[model samples]
Target: MQINKDRDWEALYLANDTFWDHGEASPGLVDYL
Candidate 1:
């Protein structure tokens, strides 16, 4: 799926519309960091 980078996903976090959030850093992304 394509993501909308223009929208502030952080605002969704502030508003608590975070059903899609995993509540932690993604394990798949740990290596990139």
Candidate 2:
């Protein structure tokens, strides 16, 4: 359960970061890949 919670948080953070990478803050969308 603890590991799962950590994974969830990591996923959320990753998603948020990915979103930001392509969000209005960027001049244009950039694929992390």
Candidate 3:
């Protein structure tokens, strides 16, 4: 799963081509902020 830096990640998410946590905001990010 070597995603290129130039790739459009938003498109992949919209197309459901990538894995992700389908829930609330990321806990780690919340804690960091």
Candidate 4:
């Protein structure tokens, strides 16, 4: 099935649902130099 990614992201932002984000990255990721 095809889903509208932009619309879904807008909904999340409008609803203030930020559980998917954190101030820092996970262990496996390295900082951008």
The prediction achieving the highest TM-score against the true structure is 3
Separately for all candidates shown, the number of backbone clashes (residues 3 or more apart, or on different chains) is 0, 0, 0, 0
Which ten residues in a row are the worst by lDDT in model 3? 16-25
Error of 1 at 7 (Å): 1.1
User: Of the pair 1 and 3, which is ahead by lDDT?
Assistant: 3
By lDDT, the best candidate is 3
N/CA/C clash count, model 2: 0
Tens digits of per-residue lDDT, candidate 4, 1-33, equal 245565577777678765667767876676443
lDDT of 3 by residue, 1-33 (tens): 785899899989888787664656788989998
How well does each candidate superpose onto the true structure, as a TM-score? 0.40, 0.28, 0.49, 0.33
| Per-residue lDDT of candidate 2, residues 1-33 (tens digit) | 234443566666666844334444443434432
Residue lDDT tens for model 1, 1-33: 347779788998899776678788888799789
Candidate 4 residues lying further than 4 Å off, grouped into runs, are: 1-16, 31-33
Sorted on TM-score, highest at the top, how do the candidates line up? 3, 1, 4, 2
The TM-score obtained by model 2 is: 0.28
Question: What clash count does candidate 1 reach?
Answer: 0
Q: State the C-alpha lDDT per candidate.
A: 0.79, 0.49, 0.80, 0.65
The alpha-carbon lDDT assigned to residue 32 of candidate 3 equals 94
Worst lDDT run of 10 residues, candidate 1, spans: 1-10
